[model samples]
Target: MEAGEDIRWLPRHTVPDDLVFPFGGKDWWLIDDRLLAMGHTEAGRVTGHEIIDAPKGSHEAVALRNALWPLAIPHGEYRP
Candidate 1:
């Protein structure tokens, strides 16, 4: 992207009952498939990052990332 963002995606809309942001509505990144760096947010702003070790729950995080990948729309194609 012109903004230097490698990839931008708009998540597909889904029913509220479905799992979304299962990690306490916080933003997160699965680092090298080994650690989960979850950001704690307040008013849409990140306040801190908490790292989750792989053995603790990285597997579930991986699965969630995999499941959501196909549902994400590239920034260039999203409508809303």
Candidate 2:
């Protein structure tokens, strides 16, 4: 993760109200908004990783990225 640049964590309760819990069955990494790496976890361990191409300029992707900013709490600044 890049300091103050490449990583962000949004508190659980601060997630968008319209979004559902367990966002997905796996963890995801959006790289440069062009590739998405999905990590499959089992028993608290990462079991596998798969990468998929993504369209960064798409309306949906742009919208999601925009919406996430307001909900994010800088790392080490969250209290819960």
Question: Best candidate, TM-score-wise?
Answer: 1
lDDT to native, each model: 0.71, 0.63
The residue pairs in collision within model 1 are none
> Over the full model, what C-alpha lDDT does candidate 2 score relative to the true structure?
0.63
Give the worst 10-residue stretch by lDDT in candidate 2: 54-63
Instruction: Give me the displacement of residue 8 in model 2, in angstroms.
Output: 1.2
TM-score, cand. 2: 0.63
How close to the true structure is residue 52 of candidate 2, measured as C-alpha lDDT? 68
* Per-residue lDDT over 11-80 for candidate 1, one digit per residue giving the tens place of the 0 to 100 score: 4355235675667766677776779998888887789999888565788777877777776777788777
lDDT per residue, candidate 2, 1-80, as tens digits? 35446456766566767774332635666666676676888899989998867464233444665678777776667665
